[model samples]
Target: MKKTLSLVAILAAGTSQAAGFQVDTHSARATGAGGAATAWLEDSSSIYYNVANMVGVKKLDITLGDTGILPSITFQRPNMEAEGQRTTLSPPPHLFVVYKPFEKAAFGVGVFTPYGARSRWEEGFSGRFRGYESSLATYYINPSFAYELHPRFRFGAGLDIARATIELTRGLDFVNSEGSVHLGGADWGSGFNIGVQAKLLDNLDMGLHYRSAIDIAFQGQADFQNIPVEFQSRLTDQKAHADVVLPSTVTAGLAYRPLNNLLLAFDASWVDWSTFSELAIRFENPSIDNPLPKRWRAKWKYSLGGEYGVTDALQVRLGFTYDPSPSPNNTLTPDLPDANRFKVSVGAGYQFKPFRADLGYQFVALADKESTAPGMPGTYSGNAHVLGLTLGFNLQ
Candidate 1:
């Protein structure tokens, strides 16, 4: 119970977004294909999707990409007029490099943004007491190795080094007046990822991948403002500590090529979000703890995509995905209002000798949800757009 509360305090605001703030837009190829590239290895960037597929890459390759995510949310109370909308745009970069020094072995490195979120609400809003400004960010660096065990089977493993940071602000009331409290923290953690790829038939490929969870303990200071003079001593800048576990994931996928120039793929993944049940922040001054509740559940996501070679130098891609939210209704807050999402994606790629460039765009439609959580009461609706571009070079 004690550990659970600490975990909740550190991760509740971080993981309350779409599928608990787990961003999957790692590569343009994957993004264009609705993140269904697990079993379809087309470029060196597959190191992050399925490292085992590296056994099929024969040259030194490097890819650089970035994703622009724009999100909007609107809220409405029963009788009051609709509130103004909140919008924010986030851009994260990705890089991957692969080298094959032997016929049966390969090595690769990847730097990607797997999770992040930001939310800001106007002051004096209806839900101001719930939260005002919040943000969470993470970066991962992975070094992986792959080996071909047989003509049709390959295995891979990698170690992940990640750094994360978080900031949260909320309104508080004292003596019939309004005030605010702010908290900030950062940490570094380690984990591992593993994968396997197999050719089930002459034209069918299958893959399985898993990433272990990383645990981070955060230590920082809590700052308060506008508090009455009486409680200033105990509410001012104080030391705080909390901990959270970044959940793991398991993915399975299959790719089939029915023609020489056309390929189709599908993937399904399960995320462990139940680890976050409660969150507690311990303060140094009064030695008191503030615990928040978040009964999140596991979530599943599904994606399908197809690629067609228009000519020797160009390829067209189309994809779709269904992503469900894991946020429990009782814990829903204004700072992280999220719902199920349906996404559509399209992209194209051009290859010129050793250089290739790819571009993709995804549109997300979020379902409207009604929440009657203790302090916050409203209906929330939102949408998102994601744009990605990747440039790669082949150095053989």
Candidate 2:
């Protein structure tokens, strides 16, 4: 029973791997530019990257988009190898609306998925005892307000409302064969975000954005199945609860335009993942409570992107990003295998009067990592392909 409860803790803790689960493809324009749209302006997605930049929108703007992520992950140990199945086609969609009520103030709302993950391993994999199937999804709704504090500066803040769901399934060693345990839960959380944008020079702009951490309390049930009649009474189904903290992040960016037809942008971000050092799960049966330790570290991410205007209504963009993993080897788990990654992206956009359409594609390559964590020791390798599309309409 203790071991079964421990798997629950691992599932909850593993879901917070921002480096592996974070969804950065909020906008096709930004995704194509390697998610480097902090200071650059021209779209309603500003409500997400840097709300202060909402001042760049016209009288009224509406943007809608979605990104499809397909990931391939594999694990190997000695002579045995296993592949993770493709679980989802698209996690969620993004929608942003910005309205300028007056010349100096702008109000906007953004709906998007910031964190999500889904993975499934083969039926007879060696690590099935730890975890074989897992999924986590979070949705965020932000209503923001921006004000022009100065002719060249603007500031904004938003209220963040989030909802999250988690599910995990793993096998239980019962001496002869294996029984399975499935746990599912859902919860709600709240946080805040703030940002500032400034025109530093005639052709240069700078922006900074911050998103606060959110604590969620999940309550659900755990179900055990296929257990032997002898142990069925001891491993009965019961309710479970866990509290998790989503990390905070800060990003700073700069955009430079050297020519009328070219725009370049760079962004750096810091994630405070150290908050997830430990986790505790309380069950309906107090005797089976379990506590787990996960000493994750903070990480930094950097990106660079450029866009060139090819014609009056056409633009092309290219971008690159370097993201490092925060999870140390000692705490790594099979549920979420993470590693440093490099991402390259390309995109194009065309405008026809009040309507604009953008298409972006990104390829993620994860560096192979060897893990020697306690009982599970193996080599993990994976990569992902992401495609995004966004449409914008200027109502004014």
Question: Scored by CA lDDT, what does every candidate get?
Answer: 0.79, 0.79
* Model 1, span 128-213: residue lDDT tens: 66667777777899999999999899999999998888787878777578888888888899999999999999899999989888
lDDT score of residue 229 within candidate 1: 85
Which 10 residues in a row give candidate 1 its minimum summed lDDT? 7-16
> Candidate 2: which pairs clash?
none
Candidate 2 error regions (>4 Å):
1-18
TM-score of each model, paired residue for residue: 0.94, 0.94
Q: How many backbone clashes does every candidate have?
A: 5, 0
* Model 1 ranges with Cα > 4 A deviation: 1-18, 285-288
Q: What TM-score would candidate 1 get against the native?
A: 0.94
Clash count (model 1, backbone only): 5
> Clashing pairs in model 1?
5-279, 5-280, 8-278, 8-279, 9-279
By TM-score, how accurate is candidate 2? 0.94
